[model samples]
Target: MTAGLSRRAAICGIGQTEFSKESGRTELQLACECVKSALDDAGLSPADVDGLVTFTMDTTEEIDVVRNLGIGELSMFSRVPYGGGAAAGTVLQAAMAVATGVADVVVCYRAFNERSGMRFGGFASTLTSMPLFLSWYGPYGLLTPASWVALHARRYMETYGVTNADFAPIAVVDRKHAATNPDAWFHGRPITVEDHQASRWIVEPVLRLLDCCQESDGGVAIVVTSTERARDLRQVPAVIEAAAQGATFDGESMTSYYRDDLTGLQEMGAVARRLWSMSGLSPDDIQTAFLYDHFTPFVLMQLEELGFCGRGEAKEFATVENLSIGGRLPINTNGGLLGEAYIHGMNGITEGVRQVRGTSHNQVDAVEHVLVTSGTGVPTSGLILGRD
Candidate 1:
């Protein structure tokens, strides 16, 4: 077996800008703001940074970040793709860099003006990534992310006797956590199952408006360094117990429609296999979790895919008493994408760091390890974070 990079690196600091509909600034400014904030939190300066990582979709380039931050020559400048799937992969990249001596002190960031700028909620012809699906969907007026996810939701619900009601607890508890998080854009706006049922349908008979995540304008960044080095830094290190990125066969950019089984996140399943093997930890060991909430149905799929519950058993497992702050496994305590602003899942990583640091607004007690995932459906990645 390979000596994986488990506990080789740790997230020394996490930072984010305020979640808002309109930041009234360029994406570059937002990126710099969060990176600087993260460095400040890590007791490091811009010059201490030698590596940088980000999403392929981010508007701010790596060189731009280096120039703006006055960071010197970088040994590593990499980008991860597949939108939200790249969230945890960024840290995976940084952990590898630090472990292999590629660089020291890396910062992973995602910043966007998605709401006041280019919105991801609505469909755009520019997204020709899934050519075959786009051709079929375009002619049938099936546009937007909700409709794309609706394709899988329909099959999942039909195959497993699931419904929109089965998905409401995730949305309800997410907003409930968001209601307490002051940084959450939807703070103070907790919703009930009745409210979720009353919301308008974004995709008929499948997804409601509340089931979809918000198109937010914000930025979040994480500072990574060797675990030994992190101990001397300003804050407690959220150690990288196991960092993994997985992309199974027959996966596309935004859709995994052609997979043999349309009911589960197979790529995330691939990630889970690596995580468990590397960390030597199981679902039972996870104190809390941050399953990607770009959509709520995927949250259920994630619970099953990660082996927290058996396949098709999430319908019974997804209760407020189960997933709440005092439950068997609290999830998305910072409200998640549905409640917090979607920095394309980067904000979820920051919250995982917070939970590990014991600084979260809805902090779970005795959190020895926190499981954080990237996007579902397509090629995805996940991380098992723990206290160092």
Candidate 2:
């Protein structure tokens, strides 16, 4: 399938910050205020950014946010490691550095305070300076991340009986689209299925503290140029029709623990079959989605590894539609990372550039296309975005 690449690269700008646990600032001032509000929403400044991409568990660096956003000359910069699976591979490394001219506007960011400052669910042993294959599962307890997603949600509920009320309809459809998304930190707090069977578990029959995801501070950014300079910039572009990153065999960043099939994520099914064969589109042309809910059973194992429900039938297609707000597909409407605010997926790629720029709060009506995924049992990435 892979036929779509025509050197496109859009998403002219998008920014974020206010999802907080306490952004009393500094993760380099939430990465220079989300890279100066994504270069003031791409009316361009910081001298039209030269290029930068982020996340190797970002702590704000890329020449210190290009010497604190007084940006100038940087042809290209990059980073992408497993945490939150490098959120759409930082806009696929700024759309392959602006579709190969090697950088024009670029920028892609992430910032963090992660719950007032470094808390990744606090449980440290400092794995003896990691990497010796994470010192064989950091001395067995598999450290945190809810016990490495409760060992693949207990082998996907013993090879698919998938219960805990089928992952409580993906945390009740991401807190019912984060209760109408007032930049959701469970904005207006929605949830039920008896509030995910009376929340709090954290890792028993798979997870709960509302099925994880929080501890945010904030920062998000986007820009990436070229689709004819993002059709004369300042918004509505969003194109980059496909981008992927995958890692399957022996992949480990969230500890793959010698996979055989811990209920399928196979690096997001190898980034959803290379993002539906490089965006020649499928999954019914994606009218909106954002997958990486950070925990909620890896958002039903990434909707059955992005074929949108079939492996174990993604908990019966997320309890018969209601994937929140008039759902057939509508996911993470901006309340992902289970109720929006997990800088690691860069605010779900800024809500997939606001659902291809029709601008979302929970808007999913005609959304041309929009897949956006990342952070699913590690070594993952995906993106599709559309509306050119």
Candidate 3:
């Protein structure tokens, strides 16, 4: 097993504002509210917080959040890149800082007004920086994220003999889980495979309307500190068993079209290898998972990449019986991004903490270890959280 930084830190607090289509509050306000709530949940004050971490895509600056929340004397602050892929990476940064004593009481947060303010699925007003790669695909109408992923999804179907009908189970299961979760936007509203098939096509033959995650406006924060200190805190410590970020050969933003295989996420596979090594635990050890579900096809790819099932077997494995509670592996108990609100994946980490703490609305029996992953098709990250 890989050594050095396993089980050094733990998440003692998780807090979030209500998920909504329109928060009616500034992103800064949403950020500060979650940060304060997380600190409160950890039985800590802003004065005790010494570090901060977030995504580079986040508009709320660290200094701005610190100043707004009255946090004093920041010792460490950092940001990860690649949009939603930075979710678990933020916690990795905080855990590393706390583990090495670079900082204590580190808080990782993500707050955005995605739905009501700026939608990721919407057209960009202007190009901030045009990389050379954009010249190849941008002119061909491969503009939005859905279109980018649809290109990969079509190739995956042809390579694996996977079909559009195969993706129905994923959507059905996610909404099934979300139906019981009151916090989910689709709470009490479950969809079937028929419902999935009836949904309008976003791209074509691959991505349907129900397959994409919601553009949500919300905020989520996690408090990380030493396990020793966390035991004395308000919540049960979800120990950081392992954490890692990975990018495979010839990786590009989401346009890694040059890879030998489009059916698998080699980047997440690299992350899986490190997590198991560092934590001294395999996929068998995990009782639950919060696999990033930004897109249904990517969820299947993650299942294969993370080794929960064999390559090209994710569709067969993504059954309602398999994904439900009391089944082999329960995923996205909080409804995932598709059913739940997307706080740029910070909410997924919060759900992982809930699993470890045995407090999920759809709580699995005796969940000692929970696996969480960030966005796929980019430089991504993953984490293993276990009971302390």
Candidate 3 Cα misplacement greater than 4 A, ranges: 125-133
Q: Where's the lowest-lDDT run of ten residues in candidate 2?
A: 1-10
At residue 70, give the lDDT of candidate 3: 86
Ordering by TM-score = 3, 1, 2
Q: What residue pairs clash in candidate 2, if any at all? A: none
lDDT of 2: 0.80
Candidate 2 similarity to native, TM-score: 0.34
Q: In model 1, which runs have C-alpha deviations exceeding 4 angstroms? A: 123-133
Candidate that beats the other on lDDT, 2 or 3, i.e. the better one: 3
TM-scores for every predicted model: 0.97, 0.34, 0.97
Candidate 1 local distance difference test against the native: 0.90
Pairs that collide in candidate 3 are none
Give the Å shift of residue 91 in candidate 2: 1.3
Model 3 residue 383 distance off true place after TM-score fit, in angstroms: 0.5
- Against the reference, the lDDT scores of all candidates come to 0.90, 0.80, 0.90
lDDT of 2 by residue, 82-104 (tens): 88888788888788777768888
